[model samples]
Target: MKDIIILMFRLMVCIFEIWMLFGFYNNFLKNKPRKSRNNIFIILVFALIIFAINSIDNTILNLICVPVVYFVLAIVAFNGNVFKKLFGTLIGTIVILGTELIIVAVLNITSKELIESSMVNEPSAFVLTIIVKMVTFIVFEIIKQFSSKESEMMDGKTFCLYILTPLSCLGIMFSVVFCRIDFTENSLAKSVLIIFFFCMLIGNAAIFYGYNRYAKILVEKEKNRRTVMEQKMELESYKKVNVANDRYITLLHDTNHHIKTVYSLLKKDKKDDAMNMLSKLFDKYEKAEMIEYSGNTILNTILSDYKEKSSKENIECDIFVERGFNIEYVDEIDLVAMLSNLLSNSYEAAAKSDMKKIRIQMFMQNDGSFSVIKIENSYTSMIVEEDSVLKTTKQNKEFHGLGIKSVQQIAEKYNGWLSSTWSDNVFKSVLILENSMC
Candidate 1:
């Protein structure tokens, strides 16, 4: 009966651990967390296998089977490249093994004392495991609910902490197990194990505290930057509106002056000169005083600023945008930086080109699902391509291409990407941002 209770307790712990391990990933992904309908079925099936293993357990066999449970849970729950899933399982297994070592070592010390006092039984050990697993489940639930889910997966090296910390715990366990040559005397070995456990706890606490604090600081900085950019965009938007109003008041006078000049040239029968004057007027007067670009005032502000800048630099910028599009969900700073870099590059290239023109195309489509921007420009000098990348002509190659890289990073934040190509002496960049409508 005691053995049966032990198996049931093991089954319960295994089920709880499975839930804790697999459910952890959902907290870190960008999408809303979802529980698979088949998750319960999978857990129950594995719990039976765990119970069977516990009933006829050999230490070696149990060690092997335990990791199988975690691996299965990871494979079922994780959505990623094979390496991510495999390494994720490896981290989970290392933590579990390290934790089990501490549990077993503590259990041995306590069980020996209880045995001496005639209070020890198989059921007592099972009860101890139940208490431990229950406490662990609570901890996992608290961490999952309270801790901030990662905005994105940690870089491979940072995630290695999940491996290194547990491996350190395992190393300490091995030192305690092998060096003393004594297993049971309530000796210095137990003290060492207890200290190692506390040390790991402190280490984990420090990591969590430091990492979360740093992440919070970064997020705050990003928000502040965006807030500043939003204000700047608003100010620019107001300036454009005011300047456009002024231009509206002067447009009639300017048209009257052009018409008088052209009419005089025609009266003199200088038809060619009249036509040249008319063409110049056409070039300068094409844009209306007030043109609606997009509903996103921030975007409109950027487009207007750069359009004026390009005109001043004698670069022709052709902009196209869809009506009634929404980009309120995007971070203003990121959007600004992306467009700023793109236009900066286009201006530089067009300044050096014979054509001296930049073609800009922006549109919203896919039922409010995406906003796309395409910029194409001509480069007169050799593109300086190496390894399929358009190398910068600036002497400081180190900093030359960072603008594009930064723009790419911004695009990635929106679940989109930036791609650039240089072909037939024409350089083009395409940025796609996923729109968040719902």
Candidate 2:
């Protein structure tokens, strides 16, 4: 009966540890509930393994086994980057183990014999286990309150910096707990030392929580900066379109003078020159004229502006648009801003490439459920990518990199998405927007 009771207590501790691990994960990683049965089963199998490992009472084996098992659990059952999941597991392990160590250290300070006997007594061990687990639970709750649900990528330096505090604190904890120092004779000093260790444990959690808050503030500031820049670009685009409109109106007012010059050349018996003059007039007219690229006026204006810029840069531009297709669901300013960013990037890329060509294709899908905008530009330079997204190769990276991100944000606003790929000296970007027309 005593053996059964001990086994039950062990099982209870195992279950509690698992619960605490899950709570730690919830602060950072998400469970893969889509495959609920598989996840639960995998966790159960690992729990049993952990329970068996704990029963062996081998310190070295348990240390090696727990982290390995949790790493596996993270990979199979958690939804996050592998590194983040592992980090979460490591933090959980440290908190639980550190709490146990400090509690034991404190118990030893009060009575060394009590600490030693707790190892052999099931009830004493049970009480100690409950104390450690309860403290761990409180620490986990404190962390969860400050944990950001949004998964932000941490750079290597920042990750190292944030993790250093907890690691150093854990080391200090180990040294304080395991060092050859007897505090049994000094009650006041022991009490103070015990309070200090507890504070250190909580302080480790506070460091990560502070990191989360700091990261969130940086993210929000970046978002605000991008918003401001995009709005400024939108206003600039609108101004340029207005300038183009005014220029076209001036060209229209000069039509009579152009016609008379061509007629005068013909009358002067210079047939070839007259033909050349007429050709120049037609070219000028075509340059200023806005081709009906799509049923959307904002799209047409943006395309016309970029097309003119492409001509000035000596970049070949080919644009094909299906007539009568429109995206009225998107706001005018957003549509203009998105297309401007995409075309601007394409123009810059094509201008620097060997081929110097840009092609744009816009059409409604067969099912009339979506509209597609595809931009392809040739490039000879190297493409820098991070996390599968293109990084800007321009010197002014601060402003340049936000172009693709802004395009993506605007696309997503209208139930749309953007994808880009580069190969064979050509880079292609495709934007898909749900068609409200149907």
Candidate 3:
């Protein structure tokens, strides 16, 4: 019974170690469910099962027990596909066993006599074995977290600390297992002091290495982030310039028509004709003035520019915009990109159809939380695809399905939802996004 209890305790330790390792991998190394309560329940259940089965004494049974523990851990960690879970767990088990062997070999070569002497007492030997198991677990976990394919920038300082601190603890354990120390005179005291000193050395070395590696990565990430910010700013400026230039060029071209109309009216020598011409000219000027929605200047410019293009293409564009809000929400450039891409795609599609017409509707929610956008356009050909992605026609090589992808990406970045459908020769795109201010 006593042996059984001891075995249960050891099994409990192994199960707990597995939970910690798997939890770390699931939480930090890969994307997983975020609810804390669900995670706790999963860990607890896995720990219980592994603890129950890991108590077997036979060598073959013990070997079988390892895979069982790993299998349970994989189930908890994966929570979905069995194949993926099995593959990951198998890989993890191999790595852990390999590391344990390496550490054991190093300890045997460096402190063979010390280890043998330490095992004289059953309690001391159990403690030493537990420590060895823990160190092996830590080393393997550290390797797994750091070596994954995920971008390091996404792993914050807390995760980095989790990996580094455990690795340092394992390194200290390695030194403790190997270092020679005279413990006969003051056994407990000498052992404590030696372990403390070994920890200090290992801790320092781990910190030094971790800092060197992570610091460089951090610096490079900062530089890359800065570069991205600069490029976004430049692109915004360029977009604004292009919109302004287009507006200016349209105004200049209209001036010639205005002059010719005025000259022709004056030559007719009728006061009423000149007054009518002047009234029409003022109406044209009023129509040229851009429409503003939600205080987003970029979007206003894009709407105005696209309206003019639609008129020129003989495409009937019907726009319905909600009242402008006082609050500053979504970045103007992003808004422009989103709207322009959607409208431009619609326009292009409409141009190919016999019935060239586009409908645009936009409105802000009463709660000031989100904005909704819907656009529909007439199209010539069927837009259905097996993959749910709309592909470009063969005739249009320069511009393809990239516009839709851009819209989708921008929506995703803002935690937005986008959907599209096509039927009865009409293509529709819809998007809903949280207001940036909220």
The model with the greatest lDDT is 2
Colliding pairs, model 1? none
Candidate 2 regions exceeding 4 Å error are 1-161, 167-184, 248-284, 436-438
- RMSD in order of candidates: 10.8, 11.6, 14.0
Which of 2 and 3 is ahead in TM-score?
A: 2
Task: Provide the TM-score for each candidate, comma-separated.
Answer: 0.51, 0.61, 0.46
Q: How would you encode candidate 2's per-residue C-alpha lDDT over 1-438 as one tens digit per residue?
A: 768866765675676577557656856787777765665566567778889999899999989898888777777777889889878878888887888898777767865656454232444454455556556655665566457453454555776676666566555644544453445556456546545554665565566657767877988998888778768766877787787688788888988888898789888888899889788878887877887777766777888888888999899999988875667888776777788788988898899888999999988886778989999999888999988878887799876788888888888877899999989999999999988767
* Better TM-score candidate (1, 3): 1
lDDT against the true structure, each candidate: 0.65, 0.75, 0.65
Sorted by lDDT (best first), the order is: 2, 3, 1
Deviation (Å) of 94 in candidate 2: 17
- For candidate 2, what is the lDDT? 0.75
**How well does model 3 score by local distance difference test?**
0.65
* lDDT per residue (tens digit) for residues 1-438 in model 3: 658745665655665556545744553334356686776676767666666665444667756777777776666456556776677667666766665577567666766686666433444444455555666555554664566444342255655775666566656655654564335566566446544544543454455347547856876775465445435744764676576767667877887887787788788776688788788777766665676644656666667777778888999999877785422566655666677668878898898898999998887785768888989999997664756767776577444555666677678778887899888899889988877776
Kindly indicate the candidate among 2 and 3 with the higher lDDT. 2
Candidate 1: regions farther than 4 A off:
1-26, 29-152, 158-165, 183-189, 250-307, 316-341, 352-355, 363-371, 380-417, 433-438
RMSD of 1: 10.8
